[model samples]
Target: MIKAKITVTLKKGVLDPQGKAIEGSLSALGFEGVNSVRQGKVFDIELTMDDKATAEKSLTAMCEQLLANTVIEDYRVEIFS
Candidate 1:
């Protein structure tokens, strides 16, 4: 079995209203020196296959097809045995 971790985040220069709101709320709660915040997503998946290469390819395909929004978001995949 193969375990894959996927991270999806907004591209640079994209406005993150949710992140900005969180940052503002943090500041309001007395958290200081926080420059900015960017929100992202992480997905932990398990594959029935054993080949890392195939697993990676499938994971990438999943990201491109449905997991991540390629236009505004970037996704990274990491595999573990």
Candidate 2:
């Protein structure tokens, strides 16, 4: 079995309203020295494949097709046994 960790994050210079809201809330709650905050999504997927390379390719394709928005977001895949 193989495991994949996919991270989807907004591109640079794009506005992150949810991140901003969390930052504001943290500051309001007296969390000092909070410079900035960005939010992202993480997906954990398990596959029955044996080859790491194939698993990686399938995970990347999945991200491109459905898990991530390529125009505004970037995705990274990490595969492990």
Candidate 3:
């Protein structure tokens, strides 16, 4: 089996209202020196296939097709056995 860890985040130059809100709240709560904050999503997927290449391809397809919006988000995939 293979475990795939996927992280999805907004592209640079794109607006992130949720991240900004969290940053504001953190500052309000007395967390200092926070220059900026960016929010992202992580997905851990377990696959029955053992081939690293196949698992990577499948995870990429999943990300492109549904997990991420390619227009505004970028994703990175890491595989572990």
Candidate 4:
């Protein structure tokens, strides 16, 4: 079996309203050093296939197809057994 960890985040130039909200909250809570915050999504997927290559390919396809908005988001896939 293989496990894939997919991390999805907004592209660097994209505006992250959620992240900005969190940063504002942190500052309000007296986190003086809080300069910026970026929010992202993580998905842990377990695959029956044991081959790492195949699992990676499948995970990438999943991200490209539905897990991520390719136009404004970037994704990284990590596979482990």
Candidate 3: regions farther than 4 A off: none
lDDT preference between candidates 3 and 4, better one: 3
Candidate 2 lDDT over residue span 1-81, tens digit each? 998899999999999999999999999999999999999999999999899999888898999999999999999999877
Model 3, 1-81: lDDT tens digits are 999899999999999999999999999999999999999999999999999998999899999999999999999999987
RMSD to truth, every model: 0.5, 0.6, 0.5, 0.6
Residue 19 local lDDT, model 3: 95
Give the alpha carbon lDDT tens digit for every residue of 1-81 in model 1.
999899999999999999999999999999999999999999999999999999999999999999999999999999989
TM-score of each: 0.98, 0.97, 0.98, 0.97
List clashing residue pairs in candidate 3: none
Q: Model 2, which residues run further than 4 Å from truth?
A: none
Q: What C-alpha lDDT values do all the predictions have?
A: 0.97, 0.95, 0.97, 0.93
lDDT of 4 at 50: 86
Off by over 4 Å in 4: none
Model 4 Cα lDDT, one tens digit per residue, 1-81: 888899999999999999999999999898898878999999999999888888888899999999999999999999877
RMSD of 2: 0.6
